[model samples]
Target: MNDKHFDKIKNNDGFIAALDQSGGSTPKALAAYGVPETAYSNDDEMFKLVHDMRTRIITSPAFSSEKILGAILFEQTMDREIEGKYTGDYLADKGVVPFLKVDKGLAEKENGVQMMKPIHDLDETLRRANERHIFGTKMRSVIHEPNEEGIKAVVDQQFDIAKRIIEAGLVPIIEPEVDINSSDKEKCEDMLKEEILKHLNELSSDQLVMLKLTIPTKANLYKELIEHPNVVRVVALSGGYSRDEANEKLKENDGLIASFSRALASDLHADQSDAEFNQSLQKAVDSIHDASVNKK
Candidate 1:
């Protein structure tokens, strides 16, 4: 692990940029950026378009480590280049830590939850990420309702994978997102928290992990999780919230910082001039940064 990057993540007052939209979410992300499905004929073309979008965001003067401590990248993005440098190297050069999304998307819904599909050749992916200078990894599972058995399974699967990631020398961001639209969202959050604490307690003092969670329905519901000795940092996902709503909710939670994807790109369009693009991105970054570092 890069100690400097580790220290920055530990101490920086900034939010992480979630640029890790993979096969499942890429189309939505592209469409939001004003690129339609008709623009891409194949997966290669689609990925290229998204890569261009990400490159624009990464190279923008507004996207700096000063207010953006880290960036979570899709595996393809990590493999690609930004201005002739590998994405991870480019990010690190710009003083931003790089994290790779390691999940192979979620499995079919079962027991009111969607667990991550098996990550085939995960060790190989981790090897490549490490070679590319990735600082950490993020994997996600989803809780659709308050099913205690299912939530426990989700958390168990996450922690099990996290240990492997840690042994390979990369911090893991365990993301068990509770669907914001669920009727019992708050109950789901509560159940999820309990399961997470159980696993966190089992970790050795030296085992540090990060968490990327959906913003809870109740403000500061994760206060104990944030303060857990085994946790390095706790971050919030926008989870379909608009930028304004996410920021408002974020400010109500003191220690949780943002790791927003859709919300971060909500104002950007592919056709916008560089000046306009940078301005919009800057505004979003500034708002998220304030919400991250300043509590209400």
Candidate 2:
């Protein structure tokens, strides 16, 4: 692990940029950026277009470390180049820590939740990420309703993978996202918190992890998790919320910072002029930064 990048993540007062939209989410991301599905004919072309969009964001002057502490990249993005440098190296050079999304998307819903599909060749993937100067990894699972058995399974699966990631010399952002629109969102949050604490307590004092969760329906619901000895930092996912709504909810929870994806790119468009695009991105960065560092 890079000590400098670790220190920055531990001490920085900025939000993480969730630019890790994978194959499944890329189309929606591109459409939001004003690129239609018709623009790309095949998987290669589709990935290329998404890569171009990410490149533009990474290169933008507004997307600086001043308000963006880290960026999570899709595996492809990590392997790609930005201005002649590999994505991870470029992010580190710009003082923004780089993380890779390592999971192979979620499995079908079962027991009222969607667990991550098996990650084949995880060790090899970690080796490549480390080679590229990536600092950490993020994987996700989904919780639909407040099913105790299912939620426990989700948390168990996350922690299990997280241990492997840690052994490979990378911090893992453990995300067991409870659907925002779930009828029992608060119940799920409560149960999820309990399960997380159980696992966190089992970790050795030196073992550290990060948590990326849905912004809880109850304010300060994760206060304990944020202060847990085994936790480095706790961040909130947008979970389909608009930027404004996410920021508002984030402000209600003091220690939790933002790691938003769709919300972060909501204002950007592929056709915008350089000046307009930068301006819009700057607005997003500034708002999220404020919600992250300047608590209400």
Name the TM-score of candidate 1: 0.99
lDDT of candidate 2 over 1-296, digit per residue (tens): 78998888888899999999988889999999999999999989999999999999999999999999999999999999998999999988899999999999999999999999999889999999989989999999999989999999999999999999999999999999999999999999999999999999999987889999999999999999999988989999999999999999999998999999999999999999999999999999999999988777
Residue 68's lDDT in candidate 2: 94
| Per-candidate RMSD, Å | 0.6, 0.6
lDDT string, candidate 1, 1-296, tens digits: 78999999988899999999999789999999999999999999999999999999999999998999999999999999999999999999999999999999999999999999999889999999999999999999999999989999999999999999999999999999999999999999999999999999999998999999999989999999999999989999999999999999999998999999989999999999999999999999999999999989
Cand. 2 Cα-lDDT:
0.95
| Candidate 1 whole-model C-alpha lDDT, 0 to 1 | 0.96
lDDT (Cα, 0-100) at 239 in candidate 2: 99
TM-score of each: 0.99, 0.99
After TM-score superposition, the amount by which residue 40's alpha carbon in candidate 1 deviates from its true location, in angstroms, is 1.3
Checking candidate 1 for backbone clashes, the offending pairs are none
Q: Whole-model Cα lDDT per candidate?
A: 0.96, 0.95
Cα RMSD, model 2: 0.6
